[model samples]
Target: MRIGVVTFPGSLDDRDAGRAVRVAGGEAVALWHGDADLHGVDAVVLPGGFSYGDYLRCGAIARFAPVMQPLVDAARGGLPVLGICNGFQTLCESHLLPGALIRNDHRKFVCRDQRLRVESTATAWTSGYEQGQEIVVPLKNGEGGFVADQRTLDELEAEGRVVVRYLDDNPNGSYRDIAGITNARGNVVGLMPHPEHAVESLTGPTTDGLGFFTSVLEGLIRA
Candidate 1:
């Protein structure tokens, strides 16, 4: 029940991510990009932000941080990792997840409450949702478009790796409106939406996002 939220230089939503973990009835551990240790956290969250100011592509530089190496290893070993927004870009750059997030098709930053359908409820971060369930979460990013080779796309589809999909319309021109995806092992997940921001009702995105954090806690407990 201990969730660590990693904060890279220039990370904006690390605090919010930690707060979400706390609200979900888990311990929140703050992790720094320069640190190499995970402090025995049961799970980790790569929160959104313009890491390294998004200087050379969204998450290119931040991927080389000390904290990410252990994350990659832990994630592969079945420790749950949730990456949001810029964090999604980092996951792709780290090769923990396939595909790259490109500039929005409109060539501008898009920010709104995005409605998404839970395409797969079997992953560690999505078990709280039933298949075909709809949830609203805030998504704000300039490089949220997802692209991959045709073969990889087909593989993802066949393997049921796609976790969430845009409901009504594609928000940022992502292929097949892929809102989120899980690794083959189903322990790691990455998405462009800001689920942490939607954890509270005052923000008005809906309380649905709480399921994501709670899902991990429940999954860990079951394991």
Candidate 2:
């Protein structure tokens, strides 16, 4: 399977995401932020970084990139998309996902090996994980706190759309310890942690993150 990783102006982990895709046995296609086409890839990853230097807001400027217009439309049509950290912020800013990522409640950047529990495996990016399974991955960000209205939060809970939840401590003070969420259709996912960083044990804290990439490939094959 082919997976595209988008590189925005300040995308620091785009290469890492591509490597993760290759490690998971898929072709990694490099996509640029200004490009208007998706190159016919089956799936896409918006890797983490300070897009547009995080000006205005974490993902405000990058949301307007030409690539994102097609991405948003494709995502709406059930194309699998995963947004990590700043990419999650971009998804929210683009209105592809609900909730906003605000400054950390502690007002500091956090970088650590965080434990997350797989809450729902119903999404394209999480089918390789078992429900309630705990995995450790790198989490790093300044504006990583997830915030949404109470009603929206309740709906997400009721619908089982909360994909990952922080284990042990709430690193960024995200609401209800939500580390990641999937869209209602389950094709799009957004998370504050860096799953791409944990796909290889040689370079990461664990290889647990590889499940995400593999899951997408498996989901596509099943489709």
Candidate 3:
């Protein structure tokens, strides 16, 4: 499988995401924000970073990039897509996913090894994790709080779209301690934690995050 990892102007983890894909035994294709072509990648990942310096909003400007148009269309067509950190913000700004990420409740940048519970394994990005399993991954963000209207939140809960929940403690004050969420179809996912950073045992806190990349590969194989 070939997975495309997009690199925006200030993307910090695009390479890490690509490495994770390769480590999971898939080919990694580099994609650019200004390009409209997806290069026929089977899946796509929007890595974390301060796109356009995070000026207008975390991902407000990025959603307007030329590449996003095709990405949005493909995601709607059931193509697997994963967005991490600022990428998650972009996904919300693009309206591909519900809810928004706001300033951390503490109004500070936080970086730590965060524990997360796998709430649902139905998504292409999380099928490798057992439901209700707890795993630790690296999380670092300034505006990582997730918020949505009561109706939307309830809808997500009712549909089992809450893919991962913060465990032990809520690091960013996300509503219902949500660390990650999936679209209704389970093809697109937006997560605040940086799973790419935890895919390698030599550098990361644990290899737990590798499950996410591997899960997508497994899903592709089954399809």
lDDT of each: 0.91, 0.95, 0.95
Task: Give the alpha carbon lDDT tens digit for every residue of 1-223 in model 1.
Answer: 8999999998999999999999899999999999999999999999999999999988999999999888889998989999999898999999999999999998988888899989998899999999999889988988999999999889999999999898887888999899889899998899998889988998756988899999999888888
Per-residue lDDT of 93-128 in model 2, one digit per residue for the tens?
999999999999999999999999999999999999
| Model 2 misplaced stretches (Cα beyond 4 Å) | none
User: Residue-wise lDDT of candidate 3 within 1-223, one digit each (tens)?
Assistant: 9999999999999999999999999999999999999989999999999999999899999999999999999999999999999999999999999999999999989999999999999999999999999999999999999999999999999999999999887998899999999999999999999989998889999999999999999999999
lDDT of 1 at 117: 89
- Write down the TM-score of every candidate: 0.98, 0.99, 0.99
Q: How much is 49 displaced in model 3, in angstroms?
A: 1.0
Candidate 2's error at 14, in angstroms?
0.2
For model 3 the TM-score comes to 0.99
Q: Rank all candidate structures by their lDDT, best first, as comma-separated numbers.
A: 3, 2, 1
lDDT of 1 at 112: 89
